[model samples]
Target: MRTRLSRALPAAVAVLAVFSALPVSAATAAVREPVPYASPVDHPSYIVTVRRDLDPADVARLVGVTPVHVFDTALHGFAARLNPAQVAALAALPGVETIEEDGTASAG
Candidate 1:
């Protein structure tokens, strides 16, 4: 004698209850901690490319360093000197695209 809506409501409630019982971590994205790149130089310099929408200076501040150079054209990013721990932390941050060693090239 129950209507279709009445019959489906209990099933929907049971599904919701099952999902609510799951751990919160299971519903959230895991934060990945990346390993820092190896370098011989102490406090090696790196070029950190961040998403265009993000501010390079802000990202630099999060890691407790100032950008040696800020790029807005052709690239949106910054250059900074970072220790191993800082490098790892920066690499793990959101909006960061890539982190590479800063090097010089000379024309022959």
Candidate 2:
């Protein structure tokens, strides 16, 4: 009886650990609330500013979009076409700094 119990203990512990981690992973995968864009557009362009440590391309990939432009030197960010849901997910990311609509600047 002792030998049987001992042999099962490690396996049981491993199974328990795996099961306990499932909920946390599932919670993280839950759908995030959609963040409305500053202006309404079918597929709006956004300039996403991220933390220095994060790569703009990687961030774009995570949100399932290809970046139209990647800025690395002066700014750490990327410009991409995104919808409201993508905007929300990108906003919720840890290293994202700001998400703003891409706009034109003209000299006066």
Candidate 3:
């Protein structure tokens, strides 16, 4: 009985050590920030400013529209008269990092 107790003590200690080294759920949760709120767009055709790094070839393949101009800027803008499916497809393109409706630009 004494030998059996000694073996069980080592196994319990090893199990506790492994679990302590593993990440706790709370540690991962602390690193995440709450998502910001975005306003809704009310128009049928709205312009969107995409990330400037969006490749012309990738945009053409996914969205079928070349930007009005491309240069050294943080963002490039475009008009998209797309349905939900089209928007989702375009958003899935590799170079696209973000999409937000161009609030300042008027389509008319």
Candidate 4:
């Protein structure tokens, strides 16, 4: 009683898993190893909001990243590319209000 897609889905997933698990030959000439899909190496970008007394740009500077943009509206914040370590450091700062990923956003 299974539909074509129902039968194919598990098979496709199994094939992908098997192929992805195969070991690469060290003799192979690639300079860098590949990072698996489930885990990625690059740091995610973030939007950081600061408290009333602190400067958003200065916070970005302290983190060793340049703020792509700074805002002074109801939410005083800046956007920067942050690694996990920088994120942890930023969270510990005295006047940091909130830090969140600059996720992909779309408007209709």
Candidate 5:
């Protein structure tokens, strides 16, 4: 009984260690950049309306490629404001086919 318990303890500890190292969700682990706009209401990032076939990880990677700040995120897309240079960089990234201005005004 003692030998069996000792072996089980090591196995349990190893299992717990591995489980703790694993990420709970791909989206949950996503780290977003901060927004510098004065008013949160006026600032909106580029709207990335993705199809259902797209993976959340890929969308997150596309968001990471853009240098501008991400204000909010959704299943289909995210809102962020990017400058011309950042927009160009984002457009160049894989899986990102378009970059458009949403016409949302910036706070003075």
Candidate 6:
């Protein structure tokens, strides 16, 4: 049994090393792109209303887009240029309240 035991020790250790490394490998996995970035948002701008409970910047990072116009205390949203894919990503964010297209209105 001595010969058999010696061979198994190295194999056991190798298994342990590989299993221990699984979490780190999974943690570092690349994030897949959510949007194809084909069509842009309506009129090249969208109003993103975020949850009242979280910071808008936090939602921004999750959506992977930058806001060109940020509303102040009067509102809880920001305006940004986004493609259809990006808008979908923004809408999927955890704390996002709503997303709407910004457009010009005529006063006749």
Residue by residue across 1-108, what tens digits does model 6's lDDT show?
256877889999999999887887586688775864433535378878887777776677666778877775877878888788888888677778888877766999
- What are the runs in model 6 whose C-alpha is more than 4 Å off? 1-43, 106-108
Backbone clash total, candidate 2? 0
Candidate 5 has an lDDT of 0.56
Model 5 per-residue lDDT tens digits across residues 47-80:
5544556643456465454423332344444446
RMSD of each: 15.5, 15.8, 13.9, 14.3, 13.4, 14.9
Candidate 5, residue 17: lDDT:
100
Better of 3 and 5 by lDDT: 3
* Per-model TM-score versus the true fold: 0.58, 0.58, 0.36, 0.56, 0.33, 0.52
The model with the greatest TM-score is 2
Q: Model 2: per-residue lDDT, tens digit, 57-94?
A: 99999989999899998889998889999999998999
Which ranges of candidate 4 are over 4 A from the true structure?
Answer: 1-41, 105-108
| Better model by lDDT: candidate 1 vs candidate 6 | 1
Candidate 3 per-residue lDDT, tens place, 33-70, comes to 88864434543444455566565445644656444444
In Å, residue 58's CA in model 3 sits off its true spot by: 4.8
Window of ten residues with lowest summed lDDT in model 1: 33-42
Residue pairs clashing, model 2: none
Q: Is candidate 1 or 6 superior in TM-score? A: 1
Off by over 4 Å in 3: 1-43, 47-53, 56-58, 65-74, 104-108
Clash count in backbone of candidate 6: 0
lDDT of 6: 0.76
**Candidates' lDDT values, in order?**
0.89, 0.89, 0.58, 0.82, 0.56, 0.76
- CA displacement after TM-score superposition, residue 93 of candidate 5 (Å): 1.4
Better of 4 and 6 by TM-score: 4
- What does candidate 4 score in Cα RMSD to the true structure? 14.3
